[model samples]
Target: MSQRKMLQLSAGVLLFLLPWFGGLVSGELSYNFSQCLDFFYKETPPKGFHAAGYQSICQRYKNQYRFASLYHRQHRAPLYSAYRLSPTDGKRPRTSWMYEPQLVFSHASPEMEPFHIPVDQNVIDSQAVLLDYKNSNYTKGHLNPSMHQGTEEDREATFTLTNIIPQRAGSNSGPWNRLENEVLRKFKAFCNGSMYVITGAMPYTSGARWINNRVSVPEYIWSAYCCPSYSTSLPKSVKSFFPSYAAVGRNDRDSGEEIVPVNVRMKASMRGYDVRRMSVETLEGILKQRLAVTISLFQGECQ
Candidate 1:
């Protein structure tokens, strides 16, 4: 081969390999919430919901970003996942669980998918994997549900362990599910503008609860939404839900009813862990009392 031709081919190969080499050198690139400031309303996340040991993670999956979360390292779970609801989403994406590479190692920038890359100890703790759910009564519950996203990619980004919490099957598949559907229906029928949603879990009052000593189990799972614009004429049944709404689902059926009152009429299987819908202020009140922090989930209370 001519020397000139060899030089040109070598240059082309170098250009093609640069990106891969850069990724290898930098490790993986994971993002923080500040990296995607546009996703939040006015570039402002929730306030007064901080904890001592929690770390903030901005979830990026398959190059499609979705939301941000406050992850509790010791608990091996998320305190909450915040996302803006997409109105055009039609179907859920077929995807697997992913993890934040930076959580376990500082060298990585982007997130990692276990199927695409070998599972590494520096990614997530061994107890945080999907295998932990096996033979367990609890389910891997999502704080930021995929159904709220606008596209398949955005939906798929929600399936990360940092966005999951240990939830009882009764709450995960029953009352909690109903609350999600109700929120979806309201968002579809009433909301006319961007909707900001934040879902999180509350730890037990006395001490930390654990699943196999790996993941922390929450005492209650709570969710709230703020829609700045919406239909003026709402149905009487849902009239109170406009602008903002919140609900708390019980993780333990045996727990007291000071916050979320269980429905006595529900069947045996779905009776406990009932979800009670309330006003945004009311939800915040409960959260403030339980979390011991004055949480402001929306800007100016979505006024």
Candidate 2:
């Protein structure tokens, strides 16, 4: 077989083996795998977006230097992978990894075939528009980030419209953003083998339609990190991303149900470990071990 054909065949085999043989061994939650990557099952609407396959967006960066908290595709998207780029006007060059999701996807559901929509790099770079909208309308948001994409191939891949989602600016750029980056940082500390991270939004209400590009906004965002078994301890820097207590907020609205209330005072304990001092090696080790702990503070009566 030609080189391209062999590559294709290998990808096909990998995808086929995912459900039966590959996942949990990597230390990811099987439940999360089913919810995020199960392609054969079709998820129903009203839940969230689901991922189809791995995109090669971060593949190139790894070769340059080991960067923690970054994620890449474990398996190729069915036919093509998507990029997950942000709108240009929002941040210049049109990017922001500071807190927002670099890209977003359909949350794989228990009942439906996994939606593996390939990001159309050509179309994304060619047609994406950051529209000026009045309040109440959702804004285009990305799950994958353009900063992570360095080459034409990388940039183009991110342009796929499928990775787009509508998101609230405060939440998207605030706690939600913090969680996404923290996950990326955690993976950088612990995973030595290839890891997969698929994120999507869960919407609260209906009719908050996406643009003509088929891009949709998310309601609740979910992600899964697959860590490989490793022999050594993680570096200190790696531990930085894993620091406890991620805060996400919801603005007060008249009609919307306050699923996530505004600044209601929530906190978690850090066990007195200084997050900034941890090394990258330590972080990677933690991820390899799948070590993460959480505690929540609930509002009274509303709990």
Candidate 3:
């Protein structure tokens, strides 16, 4: 056989053997996010976040670093995903979801692999599987939305299960969706340089919620961004949003209106899933209270 054919055969054999091989320990995923620092605003990951059962994944796809995710092992979801916004004319990579191999086997390939049948038990146990969301009445929420990515591969990389959370349909398609679009508009119109975003899931302060008793569902979704370089001539209404801006959307309307109040004027379906825009500092304060931990999304507040 030719050299190419031989290499392909070897890779196939390795995939076949990976599942049955019991030698691999399903231990802690220690992969660092340093390789993908370009995704962050100042080549810096969020700081002051000290937590166990979390893995820093430098999201790799198609042999390139696309983004970074702070994945939570126990929740089977990401704490947050950070990426620099890029303009895109690409469509969503629906039905082409993938999972992180490094989460299962430490020595496995770092690239996100498309979901396949007969998924290994280790893989299912390590992170959220497709089965967890099927008929669960919750939508697969993208922490790093595909519309924010510039290239097709970058969009596809956001579909990884590690970067998803169980979200209500109302929030996914309603106010939260609008918030994402608004951010994109700001990037396209005002931002002269990189717009670094960190979107995350916020758990309820009381207790945890789950889908299929496996993947944890977030009570609220929060996002923040830092854009240091932008047009000097800005509208008064949007001027406060420059440098850094943030928002929190209601995943469960019944959860309460303290963070984001319901817009009674809207149609019934979209009324409760309100997204409240605020300053990055305000969002940080809310996150610090909810998470019981201090996390600085930008380096020296994007200094």
Summarize candidate 1's per-residue lDDT along 259-294 as a digit string, tens digits. Answer: 888889997888888998888899888877876667
Across 1-303, the per-residue lDDT of candidate 3 in tens digits comes to: 753344323311110101111222232234335467678776666665433345778888889988888776667877788898999887886658899988787878889998889888989988899999999989999999999999887898888998899988988998899999999999999999999999988877777788999888888899999999999999998999998999999888787887888889987987788899998889878877766567677878985
lDDT of 2 by residue, 216-237 (tens): 3334433333333332665664
In model 3, where do residues sit more than 4 Å from their true spots?
Answer: 1-32
Native-to-model Cα distance after best TM-score fit, residue 124 in candidate 3, in Å: 0.9
Provide backbone clash counts, one per model: 7, 54, 0
Per-residue lDDT, model 2, residue 242, is 32
The TM-score obtained by model 3 is 0.88
Best by TM-score: 3
Query: Which pairs of residues collide in candidate 3?
Result: none
Please list the residue runs of candidate 2 whose C-alpha ends up more than 4 Å from where it truly belongs after superposition: 1-137, 147-152, 205-216, 230-262, 265-303
Cα error, residue 185 of model 1, in Å, equals 0.8
Off by over 4 Å in 1: 1-32, 49-52, 88-90, 115-118, 124-127
The residue-level lDDT of candidate 1 at 177 comes to: 91
TM-score of each: 0.84, 0.38, 0.88
Of candidate 2, the 10-residue stretch with the lowest lDDT total is 294-303
Global lDDT scores for all candidate models: 0.72, 0.30, 0.79
